[model samples]
Target chain A: MSNAAIPVTEYSTPQRGWYKRNEIAITPWLFLAPGVFFFLVYVIFPIFQSFNLSLYRWDGLGQAEFIGMANYQELVSDRAFEVSLWNNLKWLILYLLAIPAGLFIALFLNQTVTGIRLYKSLFFFPFVISQIVVGLVFTWFYDPTFGLLNVMLGWVGLGPINVLGDPSIVTYGIIAAGLWPQTAYCMILYLTGLNAVDPEQIEAARLDGARGWRMLWYVIVPQLKPATFIAFVVTIIGALRSFDLISIMTNGGPFGTSRVLSFYMFEKALSEYGFRMGYGAAIAVVLFLIMLIFIAYFLWSMFQEERGR
Target chain B: MFPTPIEKTSRTWQITYQTFLPLALLLWLMPLLAVALFSIKPEADFVSGGYWSLPTYFAGLENYGRVFFQSDMPRYLLNSVLITIPTVIGCVILSSMTGFALGIYRFRSNIWIFFMFVAGNFVPFQILMVPVRDLTLDLGLYNTKTGLVLFHIAFQTGFCTLFMRNFIRALPFALIEAARVEGIAEWRIFWYVVLPLMKPAMAALAVLIFTFIWNDYFWAVVLTQGAESQPVTAGITSFNAQYRAAYHLMSAGSIVAALPPVAMFFLMQKHFIAGLTLGAVK
Candidate 1:
């Protein structure tokens, strides 16, 4: 009886401590601590650090000099920066073509023939491989002397048109290579979305005389709104983050005509030429602000969804 | 059903589609097919500039042998495995917890925290490049696979959290409520109750993160260098440089580098698609 009383007293004393009383409120904080800490240290804080670093002139090793607005002013006169900005604009506009192209392919392949699954997977093959490999394959395909493109062109009675070598069309060539994998990605998204598509609506629309383009536009496409939204989000992100293909294919070559803001920032900060940390940070800031618009839209939409729930 | 299914179409159209299917697929995969052909061709074929013709003799064995035995491809591949596997495991573990906290709990800052992850995930790698590199260097993890793995986990946690939170939200809340009614501890409920239910999400996330971390080139370049720590994506660049004009060897190397992710996709095609299109279907 005395031993039982002693054990019960020891347990009772600490059982009602603050933690026990506030378990529900504090448990989440405990669960969230490590993830929040890691995210803050890595992803969230670096954004502001990059912003602050843009205002200072640092070569990565030497003492950073306070050079507020100088970096931004230099950006105004930099020719390479101008070229990079224009290339980025081109990327943004051209990269969006993946959506419609993807929809077309999805529509084409959404059938149940023998071995169609294999065909669908094969069609989606490009998206699965690394972009580096894609870049390399496309590079060879565009080679002037012995490329298949030239080989085909020869068959059509056209001489070799050096696609990658010609500065005028270099960006377009890279964009086309990029479109291959991107279109595959959007196609998969649409395929999944099409599975969830309401078949009854299609029947109703068909009975009401909607066919082909009209049916796809008025009935099918609306059912794919969720897919379309996801496709838009990912495609925009992919467009802006097009570093691998550019780096691999052209290396911002043909008189630096293919340099996008991302590659240019890397070149400025870390490459062999020199380290202009502040300038690179400035370029990144511009790119970030551009992406900010899309991020804001996505978050807002998601927030609306959350509140609706 | 949307395209009126090929079976329901006219005979000529059906016949055309049957023929057209292989033709379109061939066109779609032309570049890859070319690379595949290149990988199997002899050096003599490349020298003769007969790239389109059948290989003079199949050198697939020799070229792939050279890539496997005569180069640093193996080392780079090993590093990729080391880096990618750890990153996938770390992200899955970290995000699952964060997802649970956000999904099941009622907290004032929940939406804001969730938004932070979503927004961070979308930010360009360039924005995080300089500072992340700096942070890695400060920790004395420069040019190390651990450095790359740590960064990938932290960064990937953003996307994984978004995925897991949404997935968890879709799960019925009655299970959690019942567990709570039985006087289970929250962490116990997470481990025993929610974790069991999260198997599908965990599987989906595992395959997705594997592909993503495996295909990563930017961070691989930024965080590590040389064959000792570099993944195959970056290693392929150096491999090409070494065999600058050797199209057969380069093609073989590229195919070797690209094979793993392709295999992963085919093996986990369902989960991969589910993970990628988490929100695309209502």
Candidate 2:
């Protein structure tokens, strides 16, 4: 309104360039240019491209035919897809156990003792280590032939159970290995959350005889919402992205029972068998759709918070 | 404090808690302890089925020596270093600028732009896998550390921007406003006023990205094939394939691969946790 009221040629200084005149707005775009360009090229465009690619039949090296809905149609009849989807559901549900397990560990480790800092760091060791190493360590730990698990099973006079080789229990075994690090991640989040817990509230609750799980449920848990939310987000993403472990431990085997969507997509698209680019993109689309649900919820939550602020 | 601190607890319980702490830690770290034990054991022990027993002789030097000197582990480790460092530097530079823009300015598309980065960060990597690979291949960057680094920088910019923006938002706005009033250039305000204050955030992000990129097995496998370009996480699998059934050598290799990030965490423990739990507090 002010700029319209006063002529720019008469009011504005001639020495200032257009960039200086609109520095505030132009600077932001200038700053955002590289990051936005990179993100759009690599992350954003690829997403839409994946969605489009899923509708075609492409071998990745040859011509891509527009075969709309055929990939989805094949997915309906595909047993491997069924197993992968079911395993994804299993991963999503079971991976949430990390939150509670992490809370439990954090509560246990919350006390200040001599060398507690060292103890805390040591407890967080699994999370810091790469999942590949975790996979390898757990692979050896669960090894049937002279594995520590079988060794302990023998201590209890139980027969050796081949965890990775057994198709029925293979997914569960991988999930367990995944849980080890995930639990540590959650524990650390909760530990940090625990630190910022309002001491006065706790004291007041204590004065009212609120102790043990009662105080935790009503007071502590409410304060830990931020941590719980983060834990939930990371755990869900980690579960859905359970590729490296599967790739390392089982290679989607014992008849491909443990193939989650991410791993299965890689297998279909790029693995030695053949390049089913469209099929892989279709699998990836399904995974993305599943993720979109949670993404929407998260964005909505953040939006609400942003509006509140 | 929530558990009614052990200091106020019964004497016997305190004693029990003290003893239990170490025991719990031992049990929690049992698998890693097993690996550490394996890494130090002689090859003869594994052949004789002495997996659970104490080592007959210390071969820590020998096993790690083989990993460091005998295998393609060093090349893979160097590749990881090359890939990880450049990605971290690029993310830090790019996100700080984006973060500065999103944080300080109030624009019409601000919130939506912020959400885009957040949403993209949370998207499944598989969604971007095919195109990114094709793009990398087309660019003649396939089987190169530069490709991995480039993709990592781009992809990681999402989370880094989120973190950096929030960090910037928490800073005193008056400083930037003051700089502007004093006729400081906008970039000068960012460089002189904001970037100095963002050191802690950058430190936090550096360590976090270091760990993340170093442990990135998916992209390493997806983009690069051989030891020449693959990071240690992907390399460790091939390392295992080379020394199949040689648990000692594999354990040594695994330990070596996982060590850099672990060391980064411990050394930068405060910053790492701060970066990780950025949103967990508020």
Candidate 3:
């Protein structure tokens, strides 16, 4: 936060070289006003408002009642909340599968073959489309009748199955829809990373008879750490905030089996499930606190890198 | 280099690699290809049997015709364009100025403000949803494209500032000092000196912001209600609802809603990847 506070002292303090040199100065506030003002009202202020709203009960437009941590207490007992929380952990773990899937695709595409450029873009088409559309496509694919999945299953002499209608399979179905685009996203990231990988190190490894999985596990993976880190960050964030697919695919159904904290918060705060604003805010607060730990680490690492550069 | 580029392999293996490349790509893109095929299937085909096999009769025009003529797609597309273009422009300008001020000026708050913007960018949208929607309603900006644009620009500024500031900080400070030594006004230094150096950052951010805003579903739900101001994502939902039995039309609508970003990816593929993979190389 001190980084934001620095503009004032660095500009307004009397001892600066530029301050002494310029004949007259515009108000320092004039320079800082627009960005800071927007930050305060739109970004900064709403955060506190969310925190405050978590202390009360209000249904968007209704009268409010102060409940303090009562909303938080309700979260502890809500079975649906527990289910969503557990599913979110599954999402976080399963989503990392995209990182390696992406790396493998990236490595495959990194070859110097003809038509590889077209192949790369074709593989990337999923990431370009919005998740809502992806969900809709997957929903149709997963439809029990006249759908691709069932059609494929019929070939294997299996009965038609309702993937989205079964509670046990719904979260994985949605995650699979999500991974369609996510794996593409990670693939694109790693493709770029692989493009810039040092050739000398690989040549040295090759001379030592390193090849296949041995070379990949030892040399290539270490060089792709930054890409992996970024892929992990984005995948985790995408998984935790896995709402669009849930909303579009099944509305957290087969009995809210696909809900994550994001969709659950929306359902609690602003949907037909009844607007329990305080309770919703508490759910959001938990998600925020969890995300903060990752963000803090990301920023700390970024700062260290910045100082190094 | 990592896997031994396919060029140096044996001739037989090279032929195998070349043949397998397209096959792998086709398999990887099979789902999307299915969507494209489903989008063009005739109504009778869907009713007659499964969504497999090539359509006996093409209905691309008919399916697409129904999607546009029967749905609120035009209004939704308009809303997305209106909301996204200004946001791209507004965020680029605001972050450029903020980035300039932070990078060029060595003030006490420089690093702190930079990080605040970065940190704020990471906060979950849920935390901001209730308050932001309420704030929009209170300001009488709810259900309006302008309102959504304002919120997007404000939120996008955080990430853009981090990008813009880092890019600016990487430039030579001596250029600004040289301008200052010539008694150029400080603001002039920003306009004439730094702004020209900003085209690369601006280009990268533009394609990125366009895609992000185009795909935005969360804020679309919160800030805007009806088709008049709802984006393509929201457009997709109502299309999904009304065309419940019309799989062909729904598939067509999905394809249409997806075109702009897909087109953008193809056109700006280089810069798009450059922007997304920016900080991942260190």
Number of the top-ranking candidate, with TM-score as the measure = 2
TM-score of each predicted structure versus truth: 0.97, 0.98, 0.94
What value of lDDT does candidate 1 attain over all alpha carbons? 0.91
- What is candidate 2's CA lDDT for residue A258? 92
lDDT of 1 by residue, B126-190 (tens): 99999999999999999999999999999999999999998988888878777766767779989
Error of 3 at B185 (Å): 1.7
Sorting all predicted structures by lDDT, with the top scorer first, yields 2, 1, 3
Winning model by DockQ: 2
* Candidate order, TM-score descending: 2, 1, 3
The count of backbone overlaps in candidate 2 is 0
Query: Who wins the lDDT comparison?
Result: 2
DockQ of 1: 0.59
Provide all candidates' interface root-mean-square deviations. 5.9, 3.3, 3.5
How accurate locally is residue B43 in candidate 2, as Cα lDDT from 0 to 100?
98
Could you give candidate 2's per-residue lDDT for residues A1-309 as a string of tens digits? Answer: 111111223444878888777777678899999999999999999999999999999999889999999999999999999999999999999999999999999999999888999999899989999999999999998999988899999999999999999999999999999999999999999999999999999999999999888999999999999999999999999998899899999999999999999999999999997899999999999999999999999999999988876
Candidate 2 chain A, poorest ten consecutive residues by summed lDDT:
A1-10
